[model samples]
Target: MYLFKKAKESIVSSLHGDKSSPIIKINYICNCILKITLAICLWLSSLSFLALYLNADIINKSLFQLFSLSSLILSCLSFIILKRKNGTYILAKIKMYPFSFKDLVDVSLLTGVVTISVFDIILCYLYLLVAFAVFVIATCSIYECLDNPYMRDNENISSFSLSFISVLYMGLYVISNGVIFRNLPYNPLEYMGYIIKNIIEDIFSVTKKLTKLII
Candidate 1:
């Protein structure tokens, strides 16, 4: 029994060693922080739903929209600060590092968040094609980052990551449902599927276009 316990501990230790990589650490920390921000977003979304229930006046309604947008912007800024290099906005010190594919994916995800935020704000909360495109690619990128075998063997971290993502989606669903009921024309799940469909169509269209050009 003692030998078995020792073996188990050794295995656990080795599994955890993989998560110690700087890239994984940064990604995990960023995900944790984003999850917290998402919780706040969920709370605010609940309040917005309440305000709507109370039949708040136009100015109050406008303020709710403004605050929602503000929160979204802040959450996005948080992601960018942790994941990307920006000269103009200094939440953390600016430093240049060697470019890597993972970094490119992080940048692309951040770009999608920014682009989605702008469109959602300007179009009065309509989910657009670019938003859909960025969302899928970003998620795939993050999953790829988490694909290390040793890290995958770390059951605790794996559970935490799964829980965090589940909560994020739940929060998004609640907010999107609120938006849809309030006649904002955004159903989070439906919008996601729409985005996926568009992505497939766009890929096929691009393939056809390239083939025609070659022909």
Candidate 2:
């Protein structure tokens, strides 16, 4: 809730660009937490992408090694760009959309990496949930970025664009590679459209049962 409040404030501030306005200020402690978390996400991304590439032609190999390598390069670039505190200081400020991938958003995203890295068939099906999650996050992100004054700047857009593309790839790689269509129970790709919907319904069903039991 605090993060969302601050994110909302930052969005408003960007529209005004007023120094006095409360544009997403990252205090010492929160800033520290964000840096640490993003660093961990970046690290996991590196490792996961590397693992995927090495396992290319294996079950979990979703993306072409070339694409994985490109993602690695983008990660490295974003890392360096984000590390530079001066010009990139804007990142820590009006943070959302473009920078979301390189920022706090990756924490949730890393769960998909677990699915990709794990060899179990059951684990791979987690991709359905991950896909649903990515959709929600991406929709929220695009909503936040929409009509924001900060998005007008080409450089700022570039920063966000690069990070955004990498994240898109990450989300896509998660669903495409680690995911199986349950070919045995149905024809290939037959149930692909309903997979995520079914998974969500099943989750709600289980949660409802748990609630009833507790009651």
- How accurate locally, in lDDT, is each candidate? 0.40, 0.39
**Please, what are the lDDT tens digits per residue for candidate 1 over residues 1-215?**
43344455445656676754443444443345445655665565455455545554422344345444544554454444334333111211010111111112111222222211232122211222223333343344345435634445544343234334334544554454343233323355764665566567667878998999999
**lDDT tens digits by residue: candidate 2, 104-166:** 221112232211111222221232244344344444444445544566666554325423644
Pairs that collide, model 2: none
**Cα lDDT, model 1, residue 149:** 45
lDDT of 1: 0.40
lDDT of 2 at 84: 45
